[model samples]
Target: SIHLLYTLNIFEFSNTWSLTYFRPTVPTDLWDAIREVELSWAFPGHWLPSKDPVKTVYFSAGRQQWIETCGAVTRMKGLQSFTLHLSGSWFCEPVEKIPVFLEPLRDLHLRQRWQLNLPKQPYYVKEIRNIDGDLRKRGIECSIRAV
Candidate 1:
């Protein structure tokens, strides 16, 4: 059954042509299967790095829907991890912004880890380390790796 599945990846979605915009929602029927979610702004093509790499999870969805989704995830009893695969050097700011981006998941008591998959040519290592430290304080294990 789909409910027995353990992972889901919502990498990209589009209305037409290119993957310019998307607002993802896990159907209630499959929420039981969502142990991990791998999200990216654009899917890889022809073995090439995506031009529109994941900058952040601060998607501009409707505010109410965003809150509702956060509530849904918080209710998930089996959610384990969320992977944010960053494809470029867009993380120019300090660790300040990461918390707000991640605040929605703070209520996810069942979530055990948060992984940041970075590009080979990552930009701010120190900033990443700082973000890691902040998440550590929240008791969530964070792993950063260059893919």
Candidate 2:
């Protein structure tokens, strides 16, 4: 099973393949040190191997910080399900940005520290609309709760 941990600034995988996809709002020295360690230990082999499949993906982000990047993961060929751990604050993106192909997602778990706000009707009524609308549309069963 392959586990990919996506933090605010760091994107790490269980196979030791990791990268700093985006610059995080943190100290330069700290980021550099962490990056150095990750690079040194990262496996210099093919990512997303066919023989050894990726079982799960773990993602942590600050509110809507990494919406675009997270959504991109849906494009992966063999990704079936994923777990999203939210931190910092609650956030939501437009329905268009949400992945449409969620049939392959068998187990969707969302663990959040703060409140989660999804898009709502009337354009503005709730702080977070939650993912019921999006997930329901795709017939995806998800378990969402606060951590």
Candidate 3:
């Protein structure tokens, strides 16, 4: 059908365009425009690096929805609601590696190893509890249900 062919062409065009022109210096506006694409029908990003490259059952860090090289967060922009299927691996960030920018994330799920000989530190629990409390204060509905 013509619709399928046209879409395929657009996909091809976007793919080629990303490879030919997507660059870090291309400016955020350009990235936004590229992101305004028909994302659901297209697969963009194969030229950028993921915001987070590692994942584990206990943790996953960074973003991985880039549109050009397909390794960044280009597609996550403006998304109001959706399901994010993340894989759990062993190489995720340590409890100590949490960055300052972690505040904006609304949902957090942490599954730790049952056999760890280490006890939960006050700082870690405080961080999680603070984030949870903050969300609860705003009535956003939060929890740490068992996994």
Candidate 4:
């Protein structure tokens, strides 16, 4: 399991793969340091066979914040593992648009670690499953947990 610790608007990456992230107002030095780390793409039950540079990301921002920083995220060419803790506002738009927003991450290992916060309606679940299938066909893994 990965833990996201927030403290004084600073983001830190620990040896245990635990990530810390706050608002986009965090210091530039912290972000620069993050881009310089050599990280192992290992999780609790699964392990990656290779090493990468700061490939893991845990992002949890509101819709407004997401809009403000989505461009930066899309430009992250080295990202491999990403976890998104979704908020309700994420569903304000069409669910299909979610994939569109993440189109830039097609090369990522995007495994099943998405945490969704939405009602468990069959329509939403089915749509998400379809998206998951599409991503999987492209060699991307996605799993949604409604919480």
Sorted by lDDT (best first), the order is 1, 4, 2, 3
What is the C-alpha lDDT profile of model 1 across 15-122, one tens digit per residue? Answer: 112211222445654655557655443222212222443422223233334445455546655567656565533344334555544556566654355666655444
Please give, for residues 101-129, the per-residue lDDT of candidate 2 as tens digits: 23334333333121222223432234224
**Model 3 lDDT per residue over 3-81, tens place:** 3332233222233234335446444444333322222212122222345533331122122212233322224332222
lDDT of 4 at 66: 36
Residue 139 miss distance in model 4 (angstroms): 6.2
Residue 35 in model 2: lDDT: 18
Off by over 4 Å in 1: 1-29, 42-69, 87-89, 118-122, 138-141
Least well predicted 10-residue stretch by lDDT in candidate 1: 14-23
Please give the lDDT score at residue 76 for candidate 2.
Answer: 30
The candidate with the higher TM-score, 2 or 3, is 2
Number of the predicted model whose lDDT against the real structure is largest: 1
Alpha carbon lDDT of each predicted model: 0.49, 0.32, 0.30, 0.39
Q: Across residues 91-136, which tens digit of lDDT does each residue of candidate 4 receive? A: 4445665565444445434223422233455556657776676655
Q: Candidate 3: give its CA RMSD in angstroms.
A: 13.6
Location of the lowest summed lDDT over 10 successive residues in candidate 2: 35-44
What TM-score, to 2 decimals, does candidate 2 have?
0.27
For model 4, which pairs clash? none
